[model samples]
Target: MRSWNIAGTLDVVPAAERPDLLAEPVAKALRELGADTEAGVVEIDPEVADTEQFCETYGSPLDASANCVVVAGKRGGEVRYAAAMVLATTRADVNNVIRRRLDVRKASFAPMADAVAQTAMAYGGITPIGLPDDWPVLLDTAVAEAPEVVIGSGTRNGKLLVTGELLASLPAAEVIDGLAKPII
Candidate 1:
């Protein structure tokens, strides 16, 4: 297995902006789901370069990892929340499928910059464990059955790897369909 975490700290941007590495929400969610797992957060080089790199560097199972995405719907120029969990192998199609589900005129990918600021997570590293509770959370039916999965740790340089059973424990998560279909 590839060694996880470089030294002792994760590579946080702005250096000073790094927060204390703790197991608050991630652990809580796991416990709620009956998952007895342990997680460690350490600063490392940016883990958001690409999916391949994310899997390789983190020693993550490429086929089983999950990416928690925050989707939004707009009505009268106002944005509402809709969350989706998709397999790392697939992408979330927000335009055709998710918009109608959210019951909004339009749905779009919230800018990474804005999402980071709002969630206090860097772009490409947002997880669903402790997300804002107001939004409707959806877990792709595909991922709900996996044995284990890795998710974002609210930062780009770290990830919170947990069991799929643990993720299903979240009250807000609703299993849905059409996570993604890779184009050949």
Candidate 2:
């Protein structure tokens, strides 16, 4: 497997060599955002793609792992979508803060099928970096300031190591305070 050390840990390689499983839209967005330099992708055992397993297998700290969740909100018959990124130890404030931010009556995690179809990314591998332009990407202030964090690479078999600044620089990325609450 190819390897390089831009961020740390994981045998990451150039994003251009990203796996075919990565959606085209995600690859295009990564290129357009110049995230290739700030982030690197690494292949992993697909069986261990979940946050807990991946971190344990790769020896990365839990605090350095981030998760991106797709949420849907509706108001007056209009539906809106947003991607929320927060540290794995925290939970996105979907019902309250996110609903208020989306100006919707209700907000909840998007159905698995809808999220996969809309983002063209695998169910457990959505990342904030390449979200659709129209969808607002709400990034928790904590995640946005982390020195380095690992996020999904649009494919379950791959992961990306990136800095908070890199993610915040993506299109439609908005750093929000209290976007996530402590899991405890």
Candidate 3:
């Protein structure tokens, strides 16, 4: 396993043993992508997996945490799906950028059940690394350029730490400016 210096705080473990990532498909994809070494996984209490609590408990910088949200839109009887990555300090432009980019009349966050069924991962732990090939992984420029960021680990029991450049290079990822707007 490659060594990760996560601001000298997070104790990253192997992705295989991540408690919340018991799904075979999600774990296989992570291995195939070499995410174990490239993007290290850190096991944590599932209770603190949510961004706010995770950062606060782990002493991680809030700006270094990114959120991946799944969005869905339907047009002409067909539904399109996408996953958007943005820093915790900002919000995905779901109402504007995402809806326009998906070329749908409207766009909204994918339902919890649908997102879980599609990603085969926990609802709050859907990272962009191993998403479906058909779904676009929208990355905000700020997220793509950050030195390092903490994201989901395909399970609520862990988190994935990776450089923005690495995350931006995933398959089907499209990095765009203004993909997210600052949160008030």
Candidate 4:
């Protein structure tokens, strides 16, 4: 059994993987903030490619995690960008919410390669802490109530479990709503 200790929390991760400080901003920031964290490693497992599958693999309630993402778009053929942290139970309303937030005519998901290269974080594991401060980070209101929510650890092999309050305190996070909607 492998174990990872961050701040003071215990977590289970994949065995035989090296820890990279550059990859996990939440863990690094927590250490800087003096929070105790602990994590563990086990056999390696594949990561979910989509949000629905991610919730299944983690056995986490849809509302228990906040998905941080970077969306890319263009208006008048010029590129635009927006960052958002939304609840697993909701989807960002790019037209009404995120579009206006970024002040762009059109918004859409960034290409996988672009998101990975530009953000410097794994697509499945993007977290808000290490993100460039200038980008707007919209926090779904649901996340504020969760005691511990799973966020991308900036890596593919792990996830960061942290308190909602901690996320609220990030450098430039703004709490908002309508990140997700009931799938029907």
- Per-candidate TM-score against the hidden true structure: 0.74, 0.92, 0.91, 0.74
* Candidate 3 regions with alpha-carbon error over 4 angstroms: 1-8, 14-23
Cα-based RMSD of the predictions, in order?
6.0, 2.6, 2.0, 5.2
Q: Ten consecutive residues with minimal summed lDDT in candidate 4?
A: 1-10
Q: Tens digit of lDDT per residue, candidate 4, span 50-136? A: 556766664556566678878776777777776787777677776777887777777787788987876778777777766765766
For model 1, how does the per-residue alpha-carbon lDDT over 1-184 read when each residue is reduced to its tens digit? 2233322233322111223332245435445544423433445457343556766775555776677777877788777877788888888878877787888978888877767666665567777776767767777777777765666666665555455655666777777767554534
lDDT of 3 by residue, 1-184 (tens): 5666552367876665563543455567667767654566787789988999998888888888999999999999998999999999999999999999999999999999999999988989888877888999999999999988888878887788788988777888999899999999
Residue-level lDDT of model 2, residues 1-184, one tens digit each, is 2233333456667677764635577788877876665567778888988998988887878888899999998888988999999999999999998999899998999999999998989989998867888999999999999877888888898888878888888769899999999998
> In angstroms, how far off is 43's CA in candidate 2?
0.3
Weakest ten-residue segment in model 2 by summed lDDT: 1-10
Largest TM-score belongs to which candidate? Answer: 2
Whole-model Cα lDDT of every candidate shown, in order: 0.62, 0.84, 0.84, 0.63
Q: Return the lDDT, model 1, position 128.
A: 79
Q: How accurate is candidate 1 locally (lDDT)?
A: 0.62
Please estimate how well model 3 matches the true structure, expressed as its whole-model Cα lDDT: 0.84
